[model samples]
Target: MSAPEPAKKPNAAPPVTRPVFLARATYRQRRMRDAAALLPILGALLFALPLLWLGQNGGEARTSHVMIYVFAVWAGLVMLSAVITRILGIGAAPQSASDDAGAADTRRG
Candidate 1:
């Protein structure tokens, strides 16, 4: 005959669950996020400009100059975007449930 299974503990606590909150962006936050999303595209366009100009002109010295400018501009744009996001506090924490409930109460009244 198979062995009997061990008895379960009756004092075990159930798993505790907290509410999950999502961060909803405001209009300005949305706009800033959109701008951040576009940074790479803008950087690519900026990088291409000098390359295109140098490709048409075809000078060894000009080619080097344009390459340097491209790198410098690309780096500058990355830094600028970092600064903008930092100043805007783009990743601020979401409001807590209590805070949200309080705001809703104030609005309804």
Candidate 2:
């Protein structure tokens, strides 16, 4: 059996304690998350605003204008969402092992 170690001195300083917790979001990541959450709501509001205005004004037989406005709003929102996603690097191609291998092969040849 191993000899017993000497006990720690009572005068020694105690070890510092740290709190246990899961990983937290960084500032940029938190902002991206917030933006992602608000995007759909913003899109919905944009879609409804024109309709609400037209309904309030009570236009007579302007179905074509309403249809045009609705579709335009929808298309604009879709483009805006695409732009935001691209800016945030969302849905971009991931760098995988296969891609790295292909790149290495090309470099050799």
Candidate 3:
């Protein structure tokens, strides 16, 4: 007689995991928020870059050039923040007149 076959191993359950991809709108919103969160850090790093030039070329970097760079970065950051805010629907109008009325009533009460 042939040797008895080995007992079959039980199947293990697959590991739990999140979906490989998020919904399109959700993914866009998350990326936008991430960009907003990182903006300040980016701005900080950019602002600091001018300091590195202080020691270069015997410190001959012009003040006006640095000022222009700083202002340009500032303006760019502002524009980026505005675009992100608009996309995120921040500062949007109230959904309805009733919502505004309710808020006013609560404030008065």
Among the numbered candidates, top TM-score falls to 3
Q: State the lDDT of candidate 2 residue by residue for 1-109, as single tens digits.
A: 9999999898988989866753454556667777877988987887776555544366553677778978998898788777768767888899999999999999999
Residues 15-44 of candidate 1 have per-residue lDDT tens digits of 998658435556567778788888889888
Q: Which of 1 and 3 is the better model by lDDT? A: 3
Badly placed stretches (over 4 Å) of model 1 are 1-25, 54-61, 88-109
lDDT of each: 0.78, 0.76, 0.91
The collision pairs in model 1 are none
Could you tell me which residue pairs clash in candidate 2?
none
Q: How do the residues 1-109 of candidate 3 rate in per-residue lDDT, one tens digit apiece?
A: 9999989768978779999999999999999999999999999999999887864568667899999999999999999999999999888985888998999999998
What's the TM-score of each model vs. the native?
0.48, 0.52, 0.71
Of 2 and 3, the candidate ahead on TM-score is: 3
Looking at model 3, residue 75 earns an lDDT score of: 98
